[model samples]
Target: MHTTPLTADLVRGALDLERTEHGLLPHRLPARARAQCADPQLHLAESQPSGVRLVFRTRAGTVELDTLPTKRVYVGAPPRPDGVYDLLVDGRPAGSASVTGGNTLTIDMAAGTAEQRPGPVGTVRFTGLPATVKDVEIWLPHNETTELVALRTDAPVEPVPDRGRRVWLHHGSSISHGSDAASPTTTWPALAASLGGVELINLGLGGSALLDPFTARTLRDTPADLISVKLGINLVNTDLMRLRAFGPAVHGFLDTVREGRPDTPLLVVSPILCPIHEDTPGPCAPDFGALSSGRLRFRATGDPAERAHGKLTLGVIRDELARIARQRAAEDPHLYYLDGRDLYGEADSAELPLPDDLHPDAATHRRIGERFAALAFAPGGPFADRAV
Candidate 1:
């Protein structure tokens, strides 16, 4: 077997890599941005490596990766499924597996506390590959924090060459962070990037897309041919800011991105249809009854009447985002606005209701990916060939 040290050049989509006692841990946010805030939620989300993966070319019939996965458990809630690692051979789904051992993070949602327990490292192996040398991509679990301990293959491997594809940098909320998606490759962003033939650098921080200046600056500095920002859901659910602060925040965020990429095709996407937060203002709360009944669900606790006092709702946010897009597009021809509903809306809700009243299910994730690829990557789409 050929053993290779996990190096930075072999990993794609992560903004930073940290050498840990176990192995190389990929980070979606750089040190500066991560240092800007000590929010635990942000810390964990950025470390999950949603679109990160190892890319190499090899003919190894058998390949194995040693990893330490951090699995999260909500005390008293149902046990979550183990995170999935997807193996793609020559751009096609070849196989998938999950690690057996790693670390466990037991979270108490109601009490807002968490405990971490260390565990043994586990190995995932894939056998029976084609004999010819082919490109292989091992997509890390989108929802779990994993440490890359080592790589072993029956044949030697080298970094995959760049394919000259446009790099799409995307930022959004938990929905974008693959909340309920089946695996890393199937996440809406990953699927969309595949269908659109672009490289993906996903910054979909679950519950952490609060339009922080540091986050905006992170987007500003990342090198990307195309950029998209999916906002509103995190803003609404967290009830982070009211209307008075939203517009300016959006502008500031866009301004920062423009500072580094003035002519880059920038797409602003509103939140998809989340019935609970559509008409009702948010500051969403988990439905304790559902939790007690062994189901997980959320509800918007804010009153619709609060709209008069500037509380934000999904509906309100869409209008504001549209207005801002139009107001900005007048000056920036490359700026684009996409109604999130065009990807998933009320009609979609009727057919594919969000299982938890928030995040889309796996099927919905596929639906959104297909729709987004069609709308945003088509010939007339804003992200159409840069040559166009």
Candidate 2:
């Protein structure tokens, strides 16, 4: 039902993939040599005095992960060689382990956390995952820089089987990155994936969905049966570029994704409503005093008063996205548009206020997740029964 692309790029990573009669198999790179051409790493930074923190979602079932020794280590003070790591999984006190210098460890079901025991890079194994691991969350000890060098999962990810459900690939900003959400499983994207009952490849980089061409190329090369791109908010919040460049960038981004997934159900989503960007673009800054006092507050230099002077408004972004979608749909019927406001807007906020005026709170995540499932995964909508 799906057509393979003419060609594919070999991604750089130290991951090995194998397919057999049962399912896809994953193996860590062998010692003394990298399994993937490039390193598989997740970088987390702690600018403030507090230690750095790392959190991610993983299934709770039989799925497992091997955490390689974190290199490029970061700490404010002279490195503490034998610091205790207080690890929390899914908000629960899973376990605590002594972090020794120059060793990797593995955390799993039966064995909570074990040092790699002086073999190659010590491995930290995460096992005893939930059977229905909708998401995985990890909270690292505070005040130190943490770099996740490697993560390998048992995803049964053999090449697409002849008779398996399709995978949904999603790209977005912080919202998609599980910001302000209680846990990884609670992120709207994760929730949507669970309800849709599809494999997920989430490329939601917090504060980094800038419609970069390299990112577009990443999407273009990645295989998918369905794809959705959430845009606008990050561009406006950061004021990364003016309206002049945003439009063309959207066009180019979609164009790249289509290179490999020509007929895939591609949906472009504009920003959900934000008061700061309602009438003008924002370089939003919260009151530092309020922040110190534990009170959340945000202010915009480009308020409604400055709208006449030229600010980025949510309406402006929404309209531009619609324009882009219409322009492309003329040539590609598979392209679709979903106004993000339809998911959350001033109206929803009126009922359930956001924790901080910008990010949606926990309740809102559930609400939006349900709404998205209804629209994107309904029995027979435009996306339903479609193929890549």
Candidate 3:
């Protein structure tokens, strides 16, 4: 069958796009911002296109997407599975697919080095669709860096018109990036976006939410009616800063965002419950025993006594965030705080244990999404549409 090509202009939900030699690369961070940071983890996470998708109206019986996906593998660890591409017809999941044979990124945590091995591109095809015209969305891989080479459809495709939903801009670490979620749409942020009836621009870069200045600037420049930043976990896991540095960093991050959105409803959320890092400080390390058995889990390796010397634990971060929010709120009423525990606390953890001792599982994502919707997006909530 003859195919019509669709371009990046037909895509939505991505914060930025770059035209690469292969095709269009969707990025959570724009080129200007990305150029300022040389962090490999940030580079990898932003390019994965967590909330990005191609949305168009079509009646095509078959659709094809050609992509070059870069998959990651840790040395001596269990092989990772191929990232999933989720298809939605008129807003409901219709099918799923995965591409094979792309680039491979090999990481040696002990050596602190990574290398990329190039490979051929792969295609994902979805056939047997109905003839009736419908809105179709192809959600890109939430965990793999995908270079969208081509989008082909049996029928001509056009961009889905804006539905006048409020734009929600959110930034955080892996949990917000859909870590361990079963599918792209089922990610907690995605679920919350759906429930809040908003258009989401997710900047949830795994292992890279270090309160970077460029990230704050990106948020400042972006147009968003509602904004949130989930902070702390990444800092603890990386042991990036002491308590004194964290307070200023959080303030600075919020300051930059307020530059662009002076009155926007900006929310500051602390880290969710991660038992390992609650009282113990980090540099969290993977549990080798778990990994050897083909399971992945993290254990805090920093000394608890180091908390006296200004090291940060999840508990420390939460208290600091609350203090920062309260002090700032006196001057900036629009700024707000939601204890991350409210979304996923000790009680919730008891019911839905985090399988990796870090990231929440698929079921917990739903629970957090639902609770977030009620607390932040419901009537009288911080993000509620006042016009309604």
Candidate 4:
């Protein structure tokens, strides 16, 4: 087969790109923003490219992609499943694939050290596509850091022209990063983007959605028709800040974003229901008993009484977010608030419990995606007609 190489110019949705010795590494955060953060967790999450994808027009019957996926391994924890790559043809699901033989980043949480082991690249090939020319989208793995080594197709490919849809830029933690979701496209944010008919630039960095100034600056600089920032959960889980700092941090984050997009419709979403952290603070620790049984679960390690001393909890964060949104809305009509509980509340939790006691399962991702579309993007909703 005469193969044609697909380069970075043919890819869409990645915020930034870095050329590595092996190939092109797509980054969800721009270089300026990434340069400001030295946190290892943020470094890993932002480079994973959760919503970034390669979209093009092709008539090729066969497509092949070679990637160097950096898979994470926790020394004492159960191994994670391979991240999935989803292929969409003409806006419909066509097939899926997973890569193997990539580098490994092994972390010993107890020892607090991480080691990298280099490995060979792997290829994912799809054959037997329809002969007619059509749009093709290969969604990168949401959970793994993938370095695109090469792309080859039997026929030449061209970057898909902009569809003129509104760009929805969203930032949040792992739940928004597709944690435990079945595939890249099925993540709540992805599903919501599809249903809402918008282009998604997801900045849902897993375990890394602290309201950092750099992140807010990135948002301020990015162009988007609609935007949202889901806050609180990661902060609580890491116990990164106290109540005193959180309010100002949230304000500063929003203030920075507004500086660039003063009139854009911006929605602030609070964290969804997490029973373990509802009243109690966190430092969420793993449930070893569950882990021993090959199940992953988490329990809040902080005492509820600590809230009196300004330790933050999910409930407290929710109140502050609502208060901030309301106070700011008085001057900014484009700014709106959507309680996270509206998407997934205590009532929904009883029926569809979070398997990990932190992130929602696949079913819940669909539910939340559907509810978000209805509440935020439906007619008269904050984002309604904005994408159109």
Candidate 5:
């Protein structure tokens, strides 16, 4: 090995290296923040770009490679409401813990199980790291749809790098999250990240992307380089709001994201195809006959006549997003919009039926992720004008 003199200038330059303190970095942080690699906050939007890096490192062997630390939390009830969180060491099922208000949950690999006791949400410390362990991979048990309150860990914090790559913060319903998709890595956003080659901060909050102001504020307060908002489906499915509230809520949602990401690229996307609402507005109900026949179908809940004007369905949402985009374009030329049909419209669904009426399976998720990356990250794409 060639040996060069250890010079004072080399040390000076190395010490001078600095990254802006932001995003996910490794270091001694608040116990809650350190427990997870990235800040445990969700910023909802429509779509995400790719090609950004968020790196976290731990002392080699200092973190146990086979034991996972508790870093996930689920609020409210999910499809599987058995446990609030689970710990997986090295991607294998290790154990689980339950959350009761103000209760302390512990996972001690040394003890070979998890235990819950009365206490408050706080830092979680894991002993017996291999001392040669270089990193820890975290698997979030909850779907992307859920919100996060805190994270606690035992690593020193590092600064999040700008990396000169565009950051896409997206908000959408379950489809955006890993919903019916096979695994977390297969989620549309994750696939999009791999394809688009940009940094991502996903806020695909499963069923709650109803243009809630709190969700919007979450976006508003967070930082991003690019942003998008995917709307429709959820509101129609849940029958959450009427036309009056939907339109204004969308506008409000966009406005809120702008508060923090001023001058950032923003796109508004409508919902993809759903046959029942292709033309009619709706609180679309499951078709009993179709259910019995094992075909996915939906019907208007209210009067057939009223269905035409009552709520915003997939089609209606597309139209409204176009209108909204056009209306806002003069004021903000950087803002762009994409029709949901541009994604998986009726034809695509016909060929690839979603196993569930509400969520797309892994295949569809991959398809959508690829399509999104091609459009948003391709040369001269809608996001092309922005610095990416």
Candidate 6:
């Protein structure tokens, strides 16, 4: 077996790769953004690498990756399923594996404390490849903080050549971060990118997609042919801003992106049908009653009447986002609006409710991806591939 040092050249979707004692740690946010962030949530979310993957080409019939993953667990909540590593051979789903044990981060939400316990590195192995030189992608766990330890293959490996697909850069909340999706490649953004025939750079920071200036700057600097921002959920749940501030903040984020990607197709997506937060305001809280039964659920504690005073809600955000997009599109033709409910609306929610009252399940993720691909990448759509 030949072991090769993993480098940034072999990685896609990450903005930076930090050298660690174990190996390279992929970061979705650049150093400038990381330096500007003071929120521990942002730090953790960015490092989780929602859309990051290792891309290479080899004729090896066997491949192995060693990784140390930091899995998060709530204090009294039921244990989470292990993080999954998905393998794609020549852009098709090949196989999936899960490591046994690794580092754990336990959080006591009530006590507002967290503790980390380190463990050994785990290995994910694939024994039967086609033994033909083909592009391969090993997508890391979307919701776990992973440290690449080593990569070994029976044959020499090299970086995969770019397939010349248009890159789609998307930013959203935990839903886009693949919170409950089956695996990395099955995330809504990933599935959408695949169906749309584009490369992906996902900045879906779980619970951290607040309209932070640094995040907007990071998007401003990133290169892409298409760009999208799924807004509203985190802001409403975090109670980070009032309606008065959301308009300008959204505009400022787009302004920053336009500074670098002036002509790139930009789509602004409002929050999907999160029924709990649809009419009610938030500062969403976990239902401890449900947690007692090992079910994690969220409920909006803020009153619906609070909208008169400018407290943000899903309904309010959707209206404002649509208005902003429409007003701006007159000057910026490339700018577009996608009412997120159109992807997962009241009808869809009735059929496939959010298991946790916030995130879509794996099946719902696929549904949303199919909806998004049809809407955004279809002929004459905002992000349509003209070359196709």
Measured by lDDT, the strongest candidate is 1
Q: What tens digits encode model 5's per-residue C-alpha lDDT throughout 1-388? A: 1112212221100111112222121111122322332312222111111111113334323221121112222221122322223332333333443333333334332233445554333222244544433433333333321112333334442322334656667778777756666554567886786577665666665555677666677667656667888888878776777777777878888888777876778888888776666655556555666645545444656443554565666666677778888998879877988887777877888889766566677799899998898888788776663443
Question: Candidate 1's residue-wise lDDT over 1-388, tens digit each?
Answer: 9999999989999999999999999999999998999999999999998999999999899999999999999876788999999999999999999998899999988888999999999999999999899999999999999999999999999998889999999999998999999999999999999999999999999999899999899999999999999999988899999999999999999999999999999999999999999989889888888989888899999999999999999999999999999999999999999999999987889999999999999999999999999999999999888575
TM-score for each model: 0.99, 0.63, 0.96, 0.97, 0.62, 0.99
lDDT of 6: 0.93
The positional error of residue 12 in candidate 4, measured at the CA in angstroms, is 2.0
Q: Model 5's lDDT to the true fold?
A: 0.54
lDDT values for all models: 0.95, 0.56, 0.91, 0.91, 0.54, 0.93
Deviating ranges (above 4 Å) for candidate 6: none
Instruction: State in Å the error of residue 243, model 3.
Output: 1.2
TM-score of 3: 0.96
lDDT of 3 by residue, 146-208 (tens): 998987888877777887889999999999999988888889999999899998889999999
Q: How many pairs in model 4 have backbone atoms within 3 A of each other, for residues 3 or more apart or on separate chains, i.e. clashes? A: 0
Q: Write the per-residue lDDT of candidate 2 for residues 1-388, one digit (tens) a residue.
A: 1111111111111123334232222222222222212312212211110111233443434322222233222111122233334444444545444333433333221232333333223334445656544433333222222223334555522121122667677777767655556544556776676677665556665555678776677677766788999987777776677677778888888888888889889989888777767776777656455555555556555666544544556788889899989999999988989989889977897997766677887688788877787888887654575454
lDDT of 6 by residue, 110-193 (tens): 788889999999999998999899888999999999999999999999997778889999999999999999999999999999
lDDT tens per residue, model 4, 14-45: 88889999889999999988889799989999
Candidate 3 — which pairs collide?
Answer: none
TM-score-wise, the better of 1 and 5 is 1
Provide the clashing-pair count of each candidate structure. Answer: 0, 34, 0, 0, 45, 0
